[model samples]
Target: MKTKTVYCLSGLLLGLLTACQPSDSNLKNQNVALQLQQKALNSTLGYDLVESLTVEVGPRLPGTDKDIQAVNWAVNKLQSLGFDKVYREPVQVPVWHRGQAHAAVTSPYTQSLVITALGGSVATPEEGITADIVRFNSLADLKQAAPESVEGKIVFIDHKTERHQDGHGYGKTAPGRSQGAAAAAQKGAVAIVIRSIGTDSDRLAHTGMMRYQEGIKPIPAAAMSNPDADLINNMLKRSDKVTLQLFLSPESQGTATSYNVIAEVTGSSKPEEIVLIGAHLDSWDEGTGAIDDGAGVGIVTAAAKLIQDLPQKPARTIRVVLYAAEEIGLVGGKAYAKAHQHELHNHYIAAESDFGAGRIYQLDWNVNEAAVNALQQLTVEMADIGVMPGNNEASGGPDVSMLPALGVPVASLRQDGRDYFDWHHTPNDTLDKIDPAALAQNVAAYAQFAWLMAQSEIILRPVAEKQSQ
Candidate 1:
């Protein structure tokens, strides 16, 4: 039901009036926003979308056949949903194969270990490296080790990741996975294995991207389960000599084409000004990618779908971007920022839902000083979902984090991430892990936020702002 009365463009007459907006239309928008929030809270549309994605497309590792299928799926879904605009922008992404990984203790205590290769790592020799083990409790200890001692050995960094509501714990121990290979190679190690950067004690190895330094010896890197890491730690204490046979066959097969799928609900009046929300379309090879990002795609799309079906068109456009290759290194996010450099100022505000399907507990934003009060009503509307106003230092999530620096204001609806890392990059990240009710709660928050942001007389930038990307 499209509203017949289109409101005036606030961006067009901002100079003439501070917070220029029709009071009657503002109140009407609030009434619609509250209705949208209620609809979202009671709907399982988000869960249905994610279920379709995981079941139909499965895992969407960037550049894989499934990744291409996912792009096609997104286009069809957006078109089927009857959005005003649907399109895609090409993005070049590197292709890597997980192949196979095997790790086992050959000496002292012979036992197989659960492990997965870190993304972008090289394959080991066919025979694999069978060497003595050298354990380090942390990355710092590895860096300080004597070269002679680490030479001709397998380095194991047994650092453990903690659990927290905000998922800051993953950030804390992520360095060991990202830099462990480089540090181990510098100490003259043949290979490296780190404790999985997850809070779970289960025997599931968490896989993620890793980096190698220039001119440093590149070595095979992998992560062992927390229990396996603990097993190795105990093995080291009991015996003077412990050996592991490692074999990983992951390899890069050049680059491939991917796309950032874009869909929009065009505003009736202020169409030039945009209210953007996004989630990564790509996921790890391990699981169906349900929790890592399938849930995110569903959440944002469901939110936008609700807005699109609204009786009255919002004042600002609502754009939903399902980004490509975000799992590797935020490729789509960086590409979007660079491609839209000329119009960054035109973006009214943005948000992203890359965290797992969880209840949104807080609303956070990073707007200019004068624009802060414009969000008060939006924050109050979020109260029904148990969300409170958070600090202004929000990064808008992994993918959306790229826009703010390019001068686009941003917001983050912080989810309950306490159990996120447990299934983050493991085989356990599947549809069953997501609760429909919790997913609905996320949709409720996102729909209310996006609808209100588009309808309200929000100021993304103060009159004093002049710098452009």
Candidate 2:
């Protein structure tokens, strides 16, 4: 939760902020946006949608059968909710099978460990590799170490992810999980292991994407649970040397096609201009991706459903994109940028609800600074739900991060991600982690954001273009 957006709204509370409200012309829609927010706060639609998806579809890792099943579920759900249009766009995604993972300290003291293979990591030998452990405090240390210090050893990076309400710690500690293997492989290490990139003290090891260099040897990469890493650290302090045995069976199956499931509530007068909202449909196999993006799927879909119920349609289309393979590499999002290259100018704005089902506390965007003022009334309307205006510096969310650079301006309704990484990418990311009240708050913020933006006279462009002027 390091992003600080959660705690940065000190002076921007409704009346304390000045000269940021939209023009009087936009006052009519403010009432409508307020109504949408109230309706969403009382609705159980977000909780219900997530429950049905996680219970019925379970873990829908991309390229798996369940991924396709989730796609169908999304289409059916959207249509039943009476969206004007529902569709799927094909996206080719890399497929990696998580076979099995095992780790243990063989020397100093013998102890079995909980581990999970990093997504896209190569497999270890059939007999596995047992070697002396070479510990590094961070990936930078591993990169600085002499090859002689790491060769034939299991490189362990002990960088711990810090907890925050803003979820900024993940970015700081992620290099160890995403790039540690390649760094270790480059140095001739036989394998790489890192402290799980999560804040929980629980034994569930977090798993995420890791890449191999083109010409370098691909070594097995995995993450040990935080407690296991702590145990190993303690063992190192007492013993002359600690040896570890590692086994991982994950393998790549090349590429497979997945779909970005899409649904739209068409605008009454100006359907061509679109306000895009999204969440990923895929999740890691370790747990039901209930918090990672399943809640996001629920949030966006329910938000749009609320918008569609208005007596009069908004002026611009509201599009919901349930992205595919976000955990892999933002494959679906990249594909969308490519697929809709020509229509990008028509994208009024884009946003993604991928953090979790946390209460939203701030609204930020990567658009013209003037656009910020135009949406100020929106922030005021959302203030009762504890939301305030943030600066013009948001990438929206992971999947929609690509859109801002492609001429589709992006916004973020910042959720309280303080505990997001506690269960992120782990088996602990289950349905029980969600607070229905908080999830309802998210729905309210998103519904308000989407409806207000759709009906506003403001159409945002990339921030860079305006900033340069």
Model 2 TM:
0.94
Top candidate on TM-score is: 2
Worst 10 contiguous positions by lDDT, candidate 2:
1-10
Clashing pairs in model 1?
1-311, 3-311
Question: What TM-scores do the predictions have?
Answer: 0.93, 0.94
Kindly report which residue pairs in candidate 2 clash with one another: 1-164, 1-165, 1-166, 1-167, 2-167, 2-168, 164-418, 165-418
Which RMSD values do the candidates have, in order? 4.0, 5.3
lDDT for residue 316 in candidate 2, whole number 0-100: 91
lDDT of 2: 0.87
**Model 1 C-alpha lDDT per residue in residues 1-469, reported as the tens digit of each score:** 3333223334424334244344676657766877887898888889999999999999999999999999999999999999999999999999999999999999998999999999999999999989998988788888888999999898988888888999998887899999989988987899998999999988999999999999997999999999999999889889978999999999999999999999999998999888999999999999999998999999999999999998778888999999999989999998888888887788888899988998899988787655555465445756767988776677888887867667778888999999999899999999999999999999988888888888666565632232222
